[model samples]
Target: MLTNRQLQILQVIVDDFVTSAQPVGSRQISKKDWITFSPATIRNEMADLEELGFLEKTHTSSGRVPSEKGYRFYVDHLLQPQIIQADEANQIQSVFKQQMIEMEQLIRESANILSELTTYTTILLGPDVQQHKVKKFQIVPLTEQSAVAIIVTDNGHVENRLLTLPNGFSPSDIEKMVNILNDRLTGVPLQELHLKLEVEALEILKQHVKTADTVIQSLLNVSTGQKEGKIYYGGKTNMLNQPEFHDLNKIRMLMDLMDKESQLQSLFKPKDKGIQIRIGSENNHMAMENCSVITAPFSVGEEQYGAIAIIGPTRMDYKRVVTLLDMMRNGLSRALTKP
Candidate 1:
C-alpha cells in the first residue's frame, strides 16, 4: 500500500542501483527530471522505506540499497517493458539464417549470444533427446565373434556399441533377434529401450534365440551408456569476472555445483511457461545466493522443447535480459522448426 511518491522513489532506486552497482542516495533521486521533491523529502522517504524493510543502508555509506524484498517488489510491480533495438534484433535473427542448421547448433549459438550480451554465464538445457522413438536398430557383424550394434532414433540421432557374439550364436540366430527387436521396439523411446526389452520381448527372445540372455545384457549395457540432452554452457568461465564472485571460496563452491550434471538438470524444470526469475536466496542453492537466474522455454511445434537460462549477479539489467530472451525464444522456435 505504498503511496505513488514512495513507489516512484523505490523504482528509481532499483533502476539506478542495477546500472551502477552502487547504492542510491537521496541526492541522486532528487536529481531525476521528473522528481520535484527536495533532497530532504527524498531522504525521509528512503529512511521510512528502510524501516519498512524494502531498503537497507550500508554501514560505510548513507546511500540505500534494495533488499531482496525490494528487488522482488520492483520486478513484480514496477517493471517497465524495454524495447529491443533494431540492430540487436537483427543480430539474433541472423544466427539462424543459414539453411539446414540443427536444433543443437541453434541452442549453442543462443547461449553464446546471450552470454555475450549480458556479460554473464548462460546455460541452455536441450530437450530430452531420449524422448524420440527408435526408428531403426541394426547389428553389423564384423567377424564370427564380434559385431557393432547401432540404435537410430526418429530424430536422426544415433548410438552405436560393440559386443562379442555369444559362443555358437549363429547368423540365423542374429537375423531372428534383429527381427524381433525391430518389430517390438521400433516406436519406443530410447530411454525406455531397456524396459521394453526386459518385459515381453525377453520371453519372446528366449523361445527363439539360444543366447538371449547374453545379447540382452550387451544391449542393456549400451542403453546404460547413453546420455541425452547434455547441458550446453556459454561463457562458463565468465562468472569469475564478476565482482560478486571474486571470492576464492565462492568460486570453488559454484564450480563444484556446476560440475554435478545430474543436479543441474533439474534446475530448469519449470512447471509454468514464459519467463521465470529467481533471485539470490530464492534459488535455494547456497552457491547461488549472490546470483539471479532468468529462464524461459522454447519449443519445436507444439511438442519438442528445451529451456534457456541466464545467470548473473543480482544487479543485472532485468529489462534488457527479459526482452532479449523473449526474442531469442520466438526466433529459435520459428527457425528450428522450419523444414
Candidate 2:
C-alpha cells in the first residue's frame, strides 16, 4: 500500500545500500538528481517505510537500511529482469567450450567461474544418481578376503567401494557372485536394485538357502549403501570479505555450513526449474539469517536434476546475480548436453 513516492524512495535506499554497503539517509536521497522530493518529505517517506517494516535505522543515526522484508518485496515487485552483456556471455561461453568433454569438469569449471564472477561462494550439486540407470557393475578382487565393487551409472558417473568377503570365500567364488548379481540386475537403478535384492534374498534363502545368502548380503550392502550426488564448492573464503561477515562468529558459522555439504544441499532442495531467492531470515538455519541465497535448478531431460546457488550477504547485487544465474543455468544445460 505504499505510495509511488514512498516506493521510489525505498528503491533508492535499496540500490544505494546494495552498491555502497552503507546505510541511506534522507539527505543523500534528496541530493540524488533523480529524486525530486525535498529532504523533509523523503525523511517522512523513509519513516513510514520503517514503520511498515521495509526499512530499519541502525544505532541513533538518521540513516536507514532495507530490512530483509524490504529486500524480499523489492525483488518480488520492483526488480526487472536484467540482461547479461555480450562480454560476460562470451567469457562464460569460453569457459564452457574449454571444458565440454566431461560432466564433472564442466560442473567444477562452472562453479569456479560463477564464484569468480560474483565474488561469492558458489555451490554446484552434482546430478542425482538414483535417477540414472546402472550401466555396468564389476567386482575386482583386491586381496584374498577383499574385493572392489565399481558401479558405473548411465551418465558416465562411477562409484567404487571395497567389500570384505567371508573368510573362506575364494576369488573365483566372488567372480561367480558378481556374474550372478550382474546377470540378474545390471540395468536397474541402484535404488531399485536394493529393493529387488531384498525380495530375492528371501526367495534365495528359501530355495538356494546356503549358496547365495552370503553373496546376496555382500552385494546388497555395497550397492545400496553407495553415496551419490557430491557437492562441489568454490570461493569459500570470499564470504569473509563481505561486510556482514566481518564478525568472527558469523564467518565460522558460514564456514561450518559450507563444510557440511549434506546440510547445504538439504537447505536448497530442488523446487522446479525457476530461480528461487531466499532472503535473510527466511532461511531456516539460524546461522544463515543474515545471508541470501540465489538458486536455479537445471536438468538433463524432462526430470529436474540438480541446482547451483550463489551465497552472499543480504545486500548483494540481486539484479546482477539473478541475471548471471539464469544465464549460467542455460549455459550449464547446453554444456552438459554437448557431445
- Each prediction's Cα lDDT score? 0.83, 0.79
Task: Estimate TM-scores for all models.
Answer: 0.79, 0.78
> Over the stretch 1-339, how does candidate 1's per-residue lDDT look in tens digits?
888999999999999988887889999999999999999999999999999889989887889999888888888898876998798888888897976555567788889988888788888887777776787889888898888888876654567778679889888988898999899999897788889988968899999997878778788864574364668898998899888788999888888878887777777555567899998899889888888888888875457777888888887788888888888888877775664
List runs of model 1 lying over 4 Å from the truth: 135-186, 192-222, 225-228, 336-339
Q: Evaluated with lDDT, which candidate comes out highest?
A: 1
**Taking the candidates one at a time, how many backbone clashes does each contain?**
0, 0
lDDT of 1 at 215: 78
In candidate 2, which residue pairs clash? none
lDDT of 2 at 260: 86
lDDT score of model 1?
A: 0.83
Number of the predicted model whose TM-score against the real structure is largest: 1
